[model samples]
Target chain A: MKRIIEVKNLYFGYEKNLVLEDVNLDIFEKDFLLIIGPNGGGKTTLLKLILGILKPWKGEINFYDDNISKKIGYVPQFSSFNKNFPISVFNMVLMGTIDSKNFIKKYKKEEIEKTKEILDKLDLYYIKDENINSLSGGLLQRVLIARSLVADPKVLLLDEPTASIDITSQLNLRDFLLELNKKITIVVVTHDPTSFAQIYDHIACVNRRLFYHGRGELDAQLLEKVYGCPVELLGHGIPHTLLKEHI
Target chain B: MLEVLSYKFMQNALMAAFLASIVCGIIGPFIVTRRLVFISGGISHISFGGLGIAYWLGINPLYGATAFSLAAATWIGFSKQDKMSESDLIIGILWAFGMAIGIIFIHLTPGYAPNLMTFLFGNILTVPRFDIFIISILVLVITLSVLIFYKGFVSVALDEEYSKARKLPVRSLNIGLLILIALSIVTLIQVVGIILVIALLTIPVAVAKEFSIHFKKIILISILFGISICLLGLFISYYIEFPSGASIVIIGSILLGVVKGVKKILKMKLNLDETIN
Candidate 1:
C-alpha cells in the first residue's frame, strides 16, 4: 500500500489546555483505519487537524496528493451543525459539489448529476425533495454520508458516524463503509469499537498519545492505557475475552 | 391608503420599505439558519455609538453607524471560537458597552440635542430621499451577490467545518457574510432604527419558513412578507399615530403567531381524520 498522509510529531491545544500531544501516524491508500479514544480524548480534534480545519500548534501534516482538496472528503459529527436548518435533502447534498474553484460559478450539469447518483446509491433518492428537518436521525446521518460521497474523494474522514443512530442504522452504515473501503481509504474517529468490530485493518488508540496496532490481536494493556480502565469487547470473529474483570 | 401615496414623503417611505424588504428577505434566512440573531443584535446596538459620535461631529449619523457596525461585525467574526458560550458573553458585553458609549457621547455633544427618539424609535415618514437612494443601492448589491454566491453561502451557513474541508475559503466567506449583514443593519436602521432592527432582519424569515422548505423559495417568500408587513405597519402607524418601527415589529409578531396557530390546528385535524378512518 502507498502512503497517502503522514502526521509527524503533532501537538495541538486550545488556549491553555493541551488536547493532542506528540502524535504520529501514517495513512495508506485503501486503508481502513479506526481511531478509538475516550470522550474528550482529542478524537474529533485529530480529524480536524488532518482535514486542515484546525492548525497544529507544533507539527506537520504531509499530504502526498497534489490535489488534496479534491481528493479528501470529510463527514463531520452528526450534532456538529443544527439539523433544524431549513434545507432540502437534494440541496444539502448538492452543496458538496462546491469547491474553491467553482464556488462563485453556478453548479454545472455534471455536478448535479453526480449528486443525484450518490443519492441513488445511498437509497435516499425517493426522499430527495424532503426537508432535512423532517427526516429521522438515521436518514439524516445517511444524508451526511451521501453528501461526502458526492465529492468523489480518495480518502474519506468521518467523525463519530455512529454516535447517535439506532442499532440497525449503525450496522447498515458499517456495511456501507466496508463496501466503500474497497474503493478508497477511510479514517473513522469513534469511541465505540463494538459497532465496527473485526473489520478495521488497523486500530489506533488515542489519548494524548497514540498506540498503533496492525492486523492481528490487540493487547489488553493498550486498551487499558488509552481508556484508563479495563474494557470489555464483545463480538464474533474476535477474542472472546478482551480484558480482565474491572476489579 | 391611496391618498397617502400621493405625498412625496409617503412615496419615499414606501420606496424605502420595498428596498429594505428585499435586503431583509435575502439576508434574514442566513441569519436565522446560522443562529446569528444575537450577534446581529450586538452589531445593531454597537452602531448606536457611531450615531452618537456622528451627532457630536456634525456628520451623517448613517455614515457613522455604517462604520461602527462594520467594525463590530468584523471584530465579532474574527473573535468567534468553537466555544459558543464564551462568544455569547463577549457579544453581550459589547452590546451594553456600545449603548453606554452612545448615551455618554450624546450627552457631551455641545449643541441642541438631536431628537434621539427618532433614531431609537424610527420615523419612516421622515426618511429622506437620499437615504432611500442609499437603500436602493444596497438592495441591488445584496441581490447580485446572493445570485452569484448563493450555494457557497448556503454551504457555509449549513456547515462551516464541512465547507472548510472542501476548501471553500470558509473564513473569507464567513467574514464576507458578516460584513454584508452589517451593511444591511446600518441601511435598515433608517426604516426601523437600532432598537427594532433585529426584528426586521429576522421576523420575515421566521414567517416565510412556515411556507416553504426550499431555501431560495423561503427567501423569495420572506421578501414578499417583508414588503407587505412594512406597508401594513406604515398604514397602521399613519392611522393610529404609533411609532413606525414598533408597529412593524408588532404586526410581524402577530402574523407569526397566527401562522403557527393555524398550522397546529390543521395538523390536529388531519390526525383526527386519520383516527376516524
Candidate 2:
C-alpha cells in the first residue's frame, strides 16, 4: 500500500514538559488506524502532529511529497463553540463545502443534495431542519461526521468519536465507522477500551512513544506495556475477539 | 415627532442611529457568537488614541480613529494568532496604551478640549453631516461584505478548526472580520460613545437571539428593534429631559429585563406541557 503520511523522528511537548519523544509513524492509503492509550498519554498530541495542526518540536511530518498542508477531513472532539449558536443541521452540514473553489460562494444545488445524502446515510435526515443545539449526542456526532466527510477527503481524522456518547451510541458509531472505512482512510484516537475490538486495519498503541503498531490481535503483554498497567483481562465490555489474557 | 424633524441635527442623529443599528445588526451576532465582546471593547478604546492624534494634527478625528483602530485590530489579530493567552494580556495593555496616547495628545493640542463628554458617552443628537456620510459608507461596505461572505463568517465564527480542516482560509477570514470590527467600532463611536459601544454592539443582538435561531432573522430583528429604541429614546429624552445616549441604553436594559421575564414564563409553560404529556 502507498503511504499517505510519514512522520519521522518527531518530538513535541508543551513549554516545559515533554509529551512525545523520537516518535515515527507511517499511515497508508485506505487504512483504518486506531490509536489507543491511557489518559494523558499524548494520544491527542500525536494526532495533532499527524494532522499538521501542531508543529513537532524537532522532526518533520511529510504529506505525500509536499510540505504544504493537505486537505484532511477532521471531526474535532471539543469544539468549544456555543451550542446555542443559531445554525440548523442543514446549515451545519453545508459548512462541509468549505473547500469549494469559489471563496465565499453560495452553496450549490449539488452540494445541498450531497449534504442531504450524507445526513441520510448517518440516519439523521429527519432532523435536518432542527437546531444544532437541540441534537442529541449521537445525532450530533453523526452530523459532525457528515460535515467532515462531505468534502470527500482522502483521509478522515476523528478525535475521540465516542468521548461523550453513551455505550449504545458508541456501539452504533463503531458500526458506522466500520461502514465508513470502506471508502477513505480513517485515523482515530480513542481512550475507550470498549471500542478496541472494532477490527481496525492497524492498531497503534501510543504512550508518549509509538510503542506498538500492528494487527488488532495485540497480545495482553503489549497492551500492558502501552497502558503502563496490568491488562490481565480485556475490558469488561470489549468483544471476546479483542484479547486472550496472555499477561 | 414630525416637529422634531424640523431640526437638521435631530435628522442627522436619527439617520445615524438608523445606519448604526443596521451595521450593528449585521456585525453584532458574529461578535456575540464568537464571544469577542472584550475584544470589541479593547478595539474601540484603542481607536480613541487615533482621535487624540487627529486632535493634535488638526485633522478629522474620524479618519484618525479609523486608521488607529484598524492598526490596533491587525496587531491584536497577529498577536492572538501567535499566542491566545498572551493575546489576552496584550489586549489589556493595548487598551490602556491607546487611551493614554489619546489623552496625552489631547493635552498637547493647542486650545480648549471642547465637549469631550460627547466622545466619551456619545450625544448622538449632535452628529454632523460628515459623520453621517462616514457612517453610511461603512454600513454599505459592511453589508456588501456580509452578503458575499455570509457562510464564511458563520463557519469561522462557529468552529474555526472545522473551517480550517475544510480548507477555508480561516486566517484571512478572521483578519477580515477584525477589520470589519475595527470599522464598526469607529463608526459606532459617535452614536454609543466610546464608553458604551459594547452594549450597543451586544444588547440588541442579545435580545434578538432569544426570539430567533437564524442569523439573518437575528440581524433583522436587531436592526428593527434597535431603531425602535432609538426613536423611543429620542422622544423620551425630548419629553423627560434625559440624556439621549443614556436613555437608549436604559430602554435596552428594560427590554432585556422583559426578555428575561418572558423566558421564565416560556420555561414554566414548557414544563407544564411536559407534565401534561
Model 1 clash number: 0
Cα DockQ of the candidate 1 complex? 0.65
The digit string of per-residue lDDT tens for model 2 on B44-127 reads: 999889998998999988898899889988887777775898888889988999889988999899999884677777778878
Q: Quick one: best DockQ, which candidate?
A: 1
Global lDDT of each candidate: 0.85, 0.80
The best candidate by lDDT is 1
The parts of candidate 1 lying over 4 Å away from their true place are A218-231, A234-247, B82-84, B110-114
| Per-candidate DockQ vs. reference | 0.65, 0.47
Give residue B85's error in model 1 in angstroms: 3.6
- Evaluated against the true chain A, what TM-score does chain A of model 1 have? 0.88
lDDT of 2 by residue, A109-224 (tens): 88989998988888888898888888788888888888887877788888898898887988888877777778778888888644745357776667788754456466655555
In candidate 1, position A122 carries an lDDT of 94
Q: What interface root-mean-square deviation (Å) does model 1 yield? A: 1.2
Candidate 1 per-residue C-alpha lDDT over A1-247 given as tens digits, one digit per residue, 9 for 90 to 100: 8988999999998988999989999999999999988898888899999988889999999998777646888888877776768888999999888888899998899999999999999999999999988888899899998888888999999899888899999989999999999999999999887777657878777888877767556555544443433235522123444433222
